[model samples]
Target: MNIGGRALLNGIMFQSENYTVKARYDKEGNIFITEEQTPTILDNKFVSFMSSLPFLRGIVALFRILWSVRKIFIISFILVIPFTLLLQNYKVINDSNINELTIGVQYLYIVLIIIIFWGINRKYGKFHGAEHKVINTFKRYGKVELASAIKTTRISSRCGTNLVFIVVVLKLISLISGVNSPLVNLSIWLVAYEIFELQETKLAFLSKPFITIGEFLQKLLTTSEPTVYELKPAVEGINHLIKLERTNN
Candidate 1:
């Protein structure tokens, strides 16, 4: 069974084809686990049809992920607006340099997002590391126990961080080339997803540059070496997911 997951503020979430599980720690230091049916937009015929196509499938997948985290995107947008208005007041963002301003705003928005995740939500990187390690352990050894997962790498080739890196590079290229249209941005995501998937194929060597930068970024900012205590929820969530998948099979 293929598995994907995300790190939560105080824990981890793992999703399989049919089930989603979240294992978290409460303020009282107790561990709690919750399971639910996995949600998908593929139930809609139109979305399912699009997901069967090539480049469009990548776009659909991207949309699904973004929708799952819509609240974070909404909050980030709201926070950036005030900063944008403040920049406008200072005449730092003017019509004559709108493209450059857009690029600057995008960078600032990323900074704000990192600050939000790292500052307000403490231990986020540790949980993120734990999530990756558990997934890696499952893929490598078909095990999700803490002992096995704790020894695995925290960086995954399939990570969204790599996609983010590709998108950022594409966006910069578009801006520099004076082509900042919405369609261009969508195409960038399509191409980025293609490259992201290529990393798992025989042509993976071609993506070494992107992978190198992504791994560096993951190590530097996105993930921290988590303690065994921090890894508990991730292991529990993935183990539960594996059991659910096996039962269904």
Candidate 2:
């Protein structure tokens, strides 16, 4: 079973093919677990068809993941528009250079996301580390115990951080080459996703630079070494997800 998860403000969320589980600590330091059915667009015939394609499947999978967090994107969009208008009014962005404006806003959006994650990391980094550790333990040893998880590294090659790095690198290349179009954007994502997948194969060496950058970002900005307190909730979340997957099978 492939397990994936994200770190929450005070805990972690783990999801399998059938279940999404969240284990969090309240203000009183009490841990609580919640379960929900996984919501996925891949259930649709059209989406499933698209997911069967190669390059297209990467975009489809991306959309499915993004759809799960649509609310956050909506909120970010709302915030971005006003700030963009503010920049325009201040002459920070010239409307005549649409490409420049678009790229500027894209950078701003990336910055906004990073800032938000930085804030989350202030209190949640340990949980983030625990989340990666637990997943690593499960994948490597088929176990999710705290001892095994603690022994695993927090850095994960399958992390969204690597994808982010690839996107940023491609964007940088586009900017340098003065090529910014819808087609280029689409190609960037497709290529990035392909590179992401390549990291797991024999040609993984080719993606080592991007993966290294992602690991550096994870260590510097995203995750902190977790203690038993943080690992416990992460372990519980994944174990619950494993149990659900087993029962369903």
Candidate 3:
């Protein structure tokens, strides 16, 4: 069976061909990267309760995204300092803030995000590469071996890097159009995902421009070619899950 994995804080996570492993990490570094042998009411009931309060649940979800990025203190600093500068420069110095579209805030945000990513990528891109290689090799083959997995390219169509870009685009569009709504956000994500899937399959030439943007995001901000040692965590994660599945059976 194929093995697939994703990178997470302090480690990477993998799944055997039979199951799903989500990237949901909690405080204390606990994660939903593995499946329990049995389900519980707490899981079902809590999900139902959370679903009933969409807005509150959405806030919690936003916290989860923020918490994931809290590791990058420098990025956080870059984000805050620039916004403050934008406010200062674009301000009336009296009563109101800039209410219209301007390159100052939006461009600064994109630039800062890229700058932070450039630094992070150089240091940790190898692990990111390994995560992709392992998953790609497993999805095409059936297992992961360090020697073989190392041969795969780090680029992935379903990368979180692409998702990051999607969310950024969605937010910017929502801001500019003044159409901020959960339903709109969901629709944008779904549409973006479908476009990406099309590029992977039938609409290759038509989606080249969009795919190029994502590729740049991956190349500059998301990944680098991995070394064998960098692949260890991914290999181990895949093997660990496979071992559990064998025992469970």
Candidate 4:
């Protein structure tokens, strides 16, 4: 599949009944992407149904967006109570326990990374029309609009989720370390969480540099250019009234 910028697995392009796959690589690593080729059975059915009711389709689209964010909501609910308690019981450990503390922090870091990946991918997938625009713009422009496309299509993100992930990680570390004094641990966690949030914001500000580099690498590896397919005309006389108006006007 075409991954970040390298070929993957047998180093061949392949297509399945429903999807086309390609691979690519960069200095850091490789990535394989499976892109859907055809509308699914569900997509066909939904389009047919929505065609009969345009207003209802809008409602469905909104609901689908909410459904996509359900995971983030669930995680918040699961951790809120524990996080509060962890803050209440926070304590500072001595140098002797620093190693264990570091380990706990590391584990939390891993979990936060996983959470960020999951959240971003999940939200990114739901940008149906936006994804098409991104692919098309990238193909036509020759690597000029990748970051703008990504930012335009990313509708749900607002910097809050990143902060939330960092806060959750701090709470998780406190829970893992089993530190004495709930209040002390809680205080430490809150302080660290705030600092992490600041760091994330600073990192976010620097995102454009990374996007530019990635787009350059991506263009190097990409072989397929987005093509516009013509739609077949419906049976003649199907829209005779519209045709008449066009002729007269």
Task: Give Cα-based local distance difference scores for all models.
Answer: 0.82, 0.85, 0.63, 0.38
Model 3 lDDT per residue over 151-239, tens place? 87788876767756765676678767777555776666555555555565676675566677777888778788877656766776666
TM-score of each: 0.84, 0.87, 0.60, 0.24
Highest lDDT: give the candidate number: 2
Output the lDDT of residue 236, model 1: 81
Q: Once model 1 is optimally superposed onto the true structure by TM-score, how far is the C-alpha of residue 233 displaced, in angstroms?
A: 1.0
Q: What is the lDDT of residue 182 in candidate 2?
A: 84
Of the candidates shown, which would achieve the greatest TM-score relative to the real structure?
A: 2
Give the alpha carbon lDDT tens digit for every residue of 117-186 in model 2.
Answer: 6876787789989999999999988878988888899998888888888988898788778888889988
TM-score of 1: 0.84
lDDT, model 1 = 0.82
Q: Model 1, range 1-249, lDDT digits (tens) per residue?
A: 778888887899888767889999999998899998866563467887887777988978888788778999899899989987998899988899877777766668667755764552245888888989999999998877888887899998877777888887887787677787778878999998888777777999877789889888788777888998789888888898899889886
* Evaluation by TM-score, superior candidate among 1 and 3: 1
Model 1 poorest 10 in a row by lDDT: 114-123
Please give the distance, in angstroms, between residue 108's alpha carbon in candidate 3 and its true position after superposition. 3.1
**Judged by TM-score relative to the true structure, which candidate is superior, 3 or 4?**
3
Candidate 2 CA-lDDT value: 0.85
Prediction 4 TM-score vs. true: 0.24
